[model samples]
Target: MMNKIFTYSLTLAFCFFSTVSYAKKSIEHCEATQNTTSGLSSCLDVVKEAVDRELQTWINNQVFILEEFALATGRRAALDMFKRSQRNFITFRENDCRWQYLAISPGTGAASAYKKCYILVSKSRIKELEVINP
Candidate 1:
């Protein structure tokens, strides 16, 4: 059973990585832009949108897979758990970004810091979910 689980997890990870490899360039480009000051906040906003879309796509795919699994096995708990985990992740991102914002308070870089935090955290979460979920 352990071997089976490991193999399944590995396969899911490979698929997830393959899907997101194409978006890596965009992610890298946005990371590169983080240091620049020319309209940095607005630029981060756009990048955040794109990153958020990627995150959403990943979540949707996971949900669909979980739903299908539930249908086949009649084990609906996994889908519910996944939904809860996603909601918790959102709350975590918001609170974490708020902390990032506060870390730069009384400074002009606060907004950019917040947005950058969101992008970084969201990207990290995407990679994390890809590894952890089917």
Candidate 2:
């Protein structure tokens, strides 16, 4: 009975780990296909899309918090300021990433660099937004 229980436990553990490993590999498969420029572009696009979705969610949360604050405090200007600041931040992120891309040559990973910059900056902004209080 003990041996059978041990074997079953081992099998379950193996199956669980294999499933997790497969999921991770599926995500990395895009980066693995980076043998060509287009392949790398596709991988970066996937990463950028994922990060953009998360950023959008965070932005929505921030807006909601600002709206709640405005409703409670009877001050709409705070929400307006938050919206304006968010717009300005978007412009800044675009220009900054463009500058980063231009800093590199025309070819040779410029696009990837820009996409990475966007991902990093947007993720940082999401973290900042997460701390807002209504």
Candidate 3:
């Protein structure tokens, strides 16, 4: 009887953990894989697709500009910083200026130190726009 109760308790604990671990969320997103960011690959692709569809600029131009800036003098660190902040934009556009519009580049850096998924957009491209955290 004791063994039966012990086994049941262990089974119950495992089931609870498994269910909570596999939950799908919106604002709170986690990788499908175990502690790895590989699952976020699809999420990043979706974000880029949405950006391309809504924006008028050609994908070539956007990529070229991002590359150019990434190589320019005194801007490498800034570009890296932005990339690190954006986390390849997997989390979605942080500012959400569809009316004004903004461009992006793909990478694997987290948005912020405190937040795992944060998208950092260029303030220059977005004139009169403020990048505020909520």
Candidate 4:
């Protein structure tokens, strides 16, 4: 049982690390081609800022639509839930990225990793919110 648990833990770790690696590799941003850490960091910042703006736009549009629908139909739960969920998601993103930063502490890549994590998570949330009704 102990051996099994250890193996399972290793497998999970491997999968997580490989997915992160694949995501890092698959990014087509200017950061991908940057040779210097500083250059890569700067490019990642720009990319993350763009992603953040897009995410905010999605959130704003969704909230506005939901708010209008709620006002017309007298159903506020959807809007309430959506607002709550968005708050939770933002909190989760911050904590998750903070974890990513801490995971690589004492390294030059931690900040970049944190920004990349934020970009990746926010992009996923944007996709999820895009198709949501109300």
Candidate 5:
């Protein structure tokens, strides 16, 4: 009975560790696969997609708050200003990331750099918007 229990426990522990190791390796596989431009671009695309989703969520929340504020306060101008500010911010983000991309060479790291810049800026904007409440 003791040997059987020990064997089962060891098997369970091994399986658990094996699963954890595989999970980590799968996550690192993208960056570990190759150092090629395309591989890096693909990784950046994944990162950008995640950041874009987060940004969209924050934007949605902010818009909802602004909408409620406009209705409650009867100040449509606030919402309008927010819309304009968002547009201007988008333009600025694009221009800024383009500049960052251009700061590097054309082929190698520019695309990744641009995407990274977008992620960083979008996250910062989310944090900024989080401070505003209805």
Candidate 6:
């Protein structure tokens, strides 16, 4: 009888701890949704800022490596051109901030293969494109 009682007690204790552990700490979505106008706005703003920072962390590393590559290759000219042209380049605008190749001529005029071209890559796309030709 004592052995059975011990087993039952352990099982009950385990279930209680398990349920508590599984419970979420965050308030319910419906509770937030029902909040006053200003409160909801503040909550949304906080969430938005958090999401933006997380996104920046993901893209910042790629920017750092690309900056190093640009300096090493003396390709800042092409990078400047690409940034200026991004608003005009429809295809690049669609790349989700991933690296895009920009071809530029070293001379003042139109771009050409003879003058030399610079390949600009984003950090996110570097691993996949490393072994491949541009």
Residue 12 in candidate 2 has what lDDT?
A: 47
Which ten residues in a row are the worst by lDDT in model 1? 21-30
Q: Can you write out model 5's per-residue Cα lDDT over 1-134, one digit (the tens) per residue?
A: 46445544654464356446444333255457658878777876775666566556567656666687787799989788988999999999999999999999576888878877887787678668756631
Which candidate tops lDDT?
1
- Candidate 1 off by > 4 Å: 1-38, 132-134
How does model 2 score by TM-score? 0.71
- Colliding residue pairs in candidate 2: none
Alpha-carbon TM-score of each model against the true structure: 0.73, 0.71, 0.22, 0.75, 0.70, 0.34
TM-score-better candidate, 1 vs 5: 1
lDDT of 6 at 59: 35
**Candidate-wise lDDT, in order:** 0.75, 0.70, 0.36, 0.73, 0.69, 0.37
* Model 3 clashing residue pairs (backbone): 85-111, 87-109
- Angstrom error at residue 2, model 1: 27
Residue clash pairs of candidate 6: 99-122
* Model 5 weakest 10-residue run by lDDT: 21-30
Q: Predictions ranked by TM-score, top down? A: 4, 1, 2, 5, 6, 3
lDDT of 2 at 16: 57
Off by over 4 Å in 5: 1-34
Candidate closest to the true structure, highest TM-score: 4
Candidate 6 ranges beyond 4 A from true positions: 1-34, 81-134
Q: How well is each residue in 1-134 modelled by candidate 3, as lDDT tens digits?
A: 46445544654464355336424421234334325444555444443333333221222233334456666654676545555644534244444433123222333433221122221232122211112200
Cα lDDT of model 1 by residue, 1-134, tens digit: 46447655655675566556545434455556557654676667777876787788678767877887898799999999989999999999999999988988968888878887898898898888768654
In model 5, the Cα lDDT at residue 126 comes to 67
